[model samples]
Target chain A: MNPKDTSTGTLSYEQAGVNYDLIDPLKVAAQRAAAATGANLAAHGFTEVPASRGESAYVVDVGPFYLASIVECLGTKTLVADDMQKLTGKSYYDSIAQDTIAMAVNDLITVGATPLVVQAYWSAGGSDWFGDAQRSQALVAGWKRACDTCGVAWGGGETPALAGIVEAGRIDLAASCTGLVNPKERLSVGDKLAAGDAIVLLASSGIHANGLSLARKLVERLPQGYLTKLPDGTTYGEALLAPTVLYSPVTEALYKAGITPHYCANITGHGWRKLLRHPATLTYRIDKVPPVTPVLRFMQEHAKQDDREAYSTLNMGAGFALFVRAQDAQRTVEVAQAAGVAALVAGRVEAGPKQLLIEPLGIRFGDDDLQLR
Target chain B: MNPKDTSTGTLSYEQAGVNYDLIDPLKVAAQRAAAATGANLAAHGFTEVPASRGESAYVVDVGPFYLASIVECLGTKTLVADDMQKLTGKSYYDSIAQDTIAMAVNDLITVGATPLVVQAYWSAGGSDWFGDAQRSQALVAGWKRACDTCGVAWGGGETPALAGIVEAGRIDLAASCTGLVNPKERLSVGDKLAAGDAIVLLASSGIHANGLSLARKLVERLPQGYLTKLPDGTTYGEALLAPTVLYSPVTEALYKAGITPHYCANITGHGWRKLLRHPATLTYRIDKVPPVTPVLRFMQEHAKQDDREAYSTLNMGAGFALFVRAQDAQRTVEVAQAAGVAALVAGRVEAGPKQLLIEPLGIRFGDDDLQLR
Candidate 1:
């Protein structure tokens, strides 16, 4: 049960073959090249929000309003859903749809934008994949239902059978969301993130689509694979396939309450390290942390990762975080509850060297750990 | 050289393992589900343009302007680029970037929207695929160059390593474009499309990223594979990997010249059948057709497809089509030419049934040939 027990864990995201060292430079080079093209928006009467280049979503100034756009894939979570379907005889695509939608819409809301339209990208390896009417219909029903839940129009999408590129019998799911930042002043690109800001953490529903690659790697070692039961009496597959929390409603409720977060982090691929995602030289000090869910706990123990590696590489318990004025922390939590999402004041932002300190777990992430820009 | 010789080939797209019958229905089902979620847009002060549901791009009524968005993938074209790279000792990713960008941005402009920002999605089977710095940098340089050429900002993008979904050593390329359909009067979802409009056909640059699955299937039958040369002495892979034309500038130029097309069709996927894609019951009579490019001609000769199949499946020569009043035909051609795109008056829209007729080639496509909704 302790992360300090490293004897059993050898799992890290990099060891799962998704090394940031190889991937991050490409992103940094891309950001530099992307920065040069910002002026191109002027031709269409839209100007690029200079600081939005490396943010969760790309924001553009469209005269009276700022529009944000993001494209995100659900990663390998659907593979888990597929594997579970084989064991349980149930198509979990309804939740797969929610996870896919949340991955993109959640990132869009990080910049204080409310998503208006979402388009689906479903690329399958072969046409036979759709011949299974149950799975296909479940996907369709789920996509529409998720879009409705997020309050975004189910805009047109492309369904291509990419035979030779994508592996056979599998489908790759991704979504693109376009949102509006009305009133202009609501656009939060970390410009207002400063010292003494309160940090509100939102509870996640299991892994929530991140760290699935590492989680999938861990499954191979288990004697029973996805069918193995955790202490909670649920199969490992059921816990790992839990749907992601859609945070758009929480951001909407906060907006309605007239509380604009100085910055928000959609805790995704980079884990808690995302808390320092904004390019600000400040310390993120945490006094408390959420309890580890059963699935993540099972995965952490089986993978044999220490506290530092688990907290920085996986969401652990907090799926999302919002930085606000000190007095607004409790209000942010209440607003999330009104929208049916649980939240807590997990930490505070302080004027210090750039880093994150999870005091309860004794884990620290330095400024050099993340290099998005 | 005649397309009537179908005896030598059984290489239809369906036989190549990409069946439209199996794929299109899922799209239709998804579209129906998507339609139910259009009401969600109203919550963000945006209304869904009803007729836009089945169009190439999704349009939203944003008061002073209509916004259009589209997501499209290059579809195994990068596989061709990869094979060609292995043979030629050079990466054609610069052109690959253009093809990927064109797939989405061109579709966005079909609704008379000018692209404002384009985000890239480069997903590979593993991280090692990006280790080839030469190939990766070429892709980055090409993406930036294409965005600059289209007068759109290069908004942020996602590059994930999808281990088991995408095939190893291969990358899937796609883009999501958000564009502005300014003045509201410029938005064209075929409401104004009618008889007596001229059809201006714009020439294509080789295959332009479509029909590659069939094209790739043809490669296996060749003794030398990708290095095999055509009648023009260019290698089969070289011609197939040519960059797709960027038509955003043409749309922008037409708007500047005070000419609003009744409707426009980006000739992709369904080939000449796309001429009748507007859902209007009218006959598109093609008096003359652009000369088929060498690569497509080679593919037709090798694949032995009849004229009807060739015209109905591949772009053949025309890359884009614009439907405007007959009087504006010459001006449209001149405008496209001024923007450096070769275009000519190839046909006329006539009152009749829903179909497209290539008079010169004696090829015809019924309305049932394509069903996007």
Candidate 2:
């Protein structure tokens, strides 16, 4: 095992930047506010309201089918793209759009729904050079092209010209998508699972829009031009800018195959180990972990980042993880491969205390194992 | 006419302090990046995508109904809320949640769909004094309350603790809602709208979410303590923080009564006249426009705004407008009143060159007529 893969006992978001103290009070305030609204729901006319807080997405059973929608936006990624000077590249818009879709679709899929329509709201600083009619058209065109490919209808959106809040040359982009699911097939983390299931790994396309803030911090500390070069000759920016892998294909295949996995989690900004939010007496033995991609290696080498940190903070290589019956592993892999995705038997479920243990490496990674340092 | 409201000039985003030029380029870049991910939709095995851009929300057709979702966030609203030093107010979250719902549901209802579910996403700033645990809970509560009141379901959501992207105390809130629209009952803006239709008015809470950049600027320039008093003694901040009126009840009533309105428009941040976006000969005579709310009046007086400007920039007490057959005018008002809302027979729709002419006042207001001086 590489030493870099081990815990570094160093601080992260707390040290690099960001103030958790302030966040604590704000969170409390948010909860209070949300509670007040919840009390007012009946008067306001929202029926079938969820009972929990912080769950930003919801579904309503409308007769035989269900309606679901999700809202998300490209965070500081706008700033990163600006800093990297990649805003003009056609791929820039493409990546953000994908992120927007993934953010919404991933949530919808969690509840066993398929996306149908998507809407976006965009705000940008106003300048004659910035609001060029052609650029606006091109941006919208890219969104349409992406939505077209996703089998989702494109709903109308808002493009507000904000003058004060956003700095000049900066734009904020967010999207909302609606989907449909069978009420009987609604999937949630509460679904039952047993030991002895096989874990399947799906390859990821770089960072996929989640932990860019951390990545940017790490990159900023590196020596000049570190990201622009690599042993493979690909610019770090180019490598890191790889679009996120959309899991809809594999998910659909599984659905069609009549296989409902015990758990399916997308590896995003938080990584594979954090997928299970609850304690269960099951251990995961990951023996066939996919090899780390070049982007991960580059960040590790240049930023002196430890492997565990990298894996926890970014997708590394794998984009998604699915736990299913051991007997179904081969079929799952085959189905995924048939859909043009590389699926591997990365691990297995084992009987044990509710914990995530990485075999061979002798490491235990789970919610308990994660720390800012 | 108030001098402040009628002074027509170009209202560029820059004058409000947001730099749209810088933001536009960033928007272009983000869109380009998002496009790459779209191709994966096909690779992932989805079907029937649209070819229009700026559509961030999508819909899926189920046997008898269509499911649609929208994703959007309160752009710059977070900044404004933080600026007002009212981060903990229930009104803050309530208004934003209302706006999020309104943003998506308005569009859905415009096409004659019934909103069923609302999914929200909240990204808490790292330094927020309130931690996400409480904040997330509160947000869910708020969403649930909103959805329940509207007879919409509360779906789950995502609460991402974005360390680097969001500043502490500056939380971003967004929601996407899935709605059901009977195939046989679809509504479009191109429907048969003719002269002599009555334009019914539904009241608004306040400015709602749009034009914040400008409003903030004007407020910033006001003398200290300008918002300190009102005839009723409520603080200006409290008045501005009022939540938007939910139109679901009134809309649902109209739909149930089998009254196919010639046209329905949400009189949002853009005000009454911009509702005519189609290419038809139409004229609007707003003879009894609702009295401007105290909040709006105060803003106008403090900013030295003219009548036309105020009418164009703010909802000014009317949040929704409906163009109905002349015969249905009285029924529309009764329906609205039955729903516990105030309504007014504000205007009449007449045949003209796709223009909105405000008669009696002899002021014509339309998209082209809007100018920022």
**Least well predicted 10-residue stretch by lDDT in candidate 2 chain A:** A1-10
Docking class of 2: acceptable
Per-residue CA lDDT of model 2 for A310-363, tens digit only, reads: 666666677788787889999999988887788899888788765666564565
Best by lDDT: 1
**What's the i-RMS for candidate 2 in angstroms?**
6.3
lDDT of each: 0.88, 0.60
Question: How big is the positional error of residue B181 in model 1, measured in Å on the Cα after superposition?
Answer: 0.4
Per-residue CA lDDT of model 1 for B1-373, tens digit only, reads: 2233332566786666577778777877888889989888878777999999888999999887888898999898988888888888899998999999999999999999989889999998888777788888999999999999999988988899887999998888889999878888999898999889999999999999889988888887799999998999999999998899999899899999999999999999878888978887899999998889999998888888888888878999999999999999999999999999999999999999888888888877888888766
Clashing pairs in 1: A8-A304, A9-A303, A9-A304
Error of 2 at A370 (Å): 7.2
Give the worst 10-residue stretch by lDDT in candidate 2 chain B: B47-56
lDDT by residue (tens digit), candidate 1, A18-109: 76667777887888899999988776666888878778999999987888898898899889989999988999988898999999999999
DockQ of each: 0.82, 0.29
